[model samples]
Target: MTRPLRVVAAMSGGVDSAVAAARAKEAGHDVTGVHLALSRNPASYRTGARGCCTIEDANDARRAADVIGIPFYVWDLSDRFHEDVVEDFMGEYAAGRTPNPCLRCNEKIKFAAVLDRALALGFDAVATGHYARLRTGDDGLVELHRAIDGGKDQSYVLGVLDQAQLRHSLFPLGDTPKPEVRREAAARGLLVADKPDSHDICFVADGDNAGWLREKLGDRAPNQGGAIVDESGEVLGRHQGTYAFTIGQRKGLRLGRPAPDGRPRFVLDIEPVSGTVTVGPREHLAVDGLTGIRPRWCGTVPGTLDGPGVTVQLRAHGEEHRAVVRVTGEKSAQTVEIDLLDPAYGIAPGQAAVVYDGGRVVGSATISATRRAAVSAR
Candidate 1:
């Protein structure tokens, strides 16, 4: 019989995690469940009708742990979470860039904080319900892979994991579909089996990010509202706040009149300093290349200066584009240049460009600039 492996699984009081714990135990591992206390006021957020991270979730986790005969503990990580994830989120929004808090959470909280704590407590591995897989290659290097359940695959959000962290991580739910996880939870009589998944940003549970920012930052600076213009600088309509809009957004512009060409208009650019929201035909939004800053390679594999071709995912659900990656520095500072195969629309700065090689994730970098073919000459 195989020896039991000591594993600490992060339990979010969801069905997937409950089933993950069950699977880990079924695989003959000594499992301990941990619930990360990320928010000081979890009750304020409505995670569907179920509420979020409330006392109820902790109780449910404890009950599941009891059923599984594994010990359960809650770790208060609210301070770290706020500093690493929440503050960065607000800072990005204030800087006129859209930030993926989930990515930040995975990079800073899950892999860094939780993994660190688990190691300090003498656990051999840290596990989570994230829909991503890890594989040990012939070279003995750990590779991050897309989950078997492609529909729920979450590798994009976990692009920042280094090889060491991946080596000591387990994703028991990676091979199971969401429905199957729920079924497993039910089979084990776990109370979270039918519990609805938390959809909103765990911290900003209300889905009103702008409102949350307003409360935190007070009144925003009053920049003169200006025209939503076309590529030729032709004025289309007025806007309230450039920060409130994003690229490819078509609604709520409140244009006073219809376009002469009768085609729908979409926001193409947001100039925060000028408070200009530029709107135009959809074609104007396409771009073929993006430059990323602070590039981080997942493994110790030094990035090549000669550049290598890779598949780049610019957004969470965005389609992958063929690109070539070139690293520009050594040591603490590095930049990545990605040359795309085809023009991508609505590319936003401060978003992550997750690079993937086949099913294995390479690494990710922050989008700092974009180059449109038309504007490059100028």
Candidate 2:
């Protein structure tokens, strides 16, 4: 019989993590639950609320651990969270870029910081409730694959994991659907069996990041006012802050004049330096190619410029578009180019472009540029 492995499961006090701990225990592994303390705000907690990393969440994790018959602890990582996740989120927004804080949390907090801490504490592997799977390839290499529940697959957000991290991570819930997870939690008598899934940014419990940023960066919001123009450079209206908008946004631009064709205008670009919010028809947002930097691969695939064709996801919950990936530069400093099979809309710089071969994740990178083909004149 194989010996039981000591596993540290990151519990967010949600049904997923609670069931994950129970599943690990059922698999005969020695399990421990750890909840991250991600924020310093005292009012961040609501009784029986479904926000990750809150005091209430920590207590719920403790209760789940009790049911699973394992030890549990709360790790105070607020300082690092502030530095890596929160600060970056604010900086990206201020620069007129939409940032994915969950991706940052997965990269810095869960995989890097918490994994290091777990290893130092004598655990053989760290587990999470993420809806993704890790498997050993025929070549004895670790590979990341999409979870069985396609609707809940979180591989896009986790595409930043490197080979080393993938080797020591376990996602026991990947093969199970969310409904079954809840059933398992109930069968195990876990208190979080019916807990609502936490959807808002865990640290920003109130989902008021712009409001929070307004408070933290009072009067520091970019004020370089510029024209909101159309494709022909005709000024449509004025905008207060370009940082408040993102690519492909349609509403909130109080343009006084109607379009010549009576169509709604969408945000085409946000120029931070000039503080301009460019608006145009929806077709202007489509792009055919994307270039990104600092690529990270989870499997043993060679990190080279030329590769077989793969599918790329440009945003969370976005459709997977067929593409060809090419890497450039030395391993230490690399850039990736992805030529899409079909034009993708709302391709934004600073967003992640995760590549996949069918269900298996190939790698991912931060988008640096997006190129669109010029439409031929009729």
Question: Which candidate leads in TM-score?
Answer: 2
Cand. 2 Cα-lDDT: 0.82
Q: Write the per-residue lDDT of candidate 1 for residues 1-378, one digit (tens) a residue.
A: 547788998888777777888788889999999988887776733457533667677777788888888999999998998999988987676666778888999989988999998899898888888999888788788888888988888999989888888878889888778888888788888888888887757766677665666666544534435567777888777765565677778877788777778888888877877777778777777888888887767775446432344688887777888877777786577888888876788888888998887777888899988886464321
Q: How badly does each model clash, as a count of residue pairs?
A: 0, 1
Q: Least accurate stretch of 10 residues (summed lDDT) in model 2? A: 300-309
Question: What TM-score goes with each of the models?
Answer: 0.90, 0.93
lDDT of 2 by residue, 218-333 (tens): 56777635689988888989876666677888877889988898988998888887878888878878899999887888875454433454689988788988887878788888
lDDT of each: 0.79, 0.82
lDDT of 2 at 261: 89
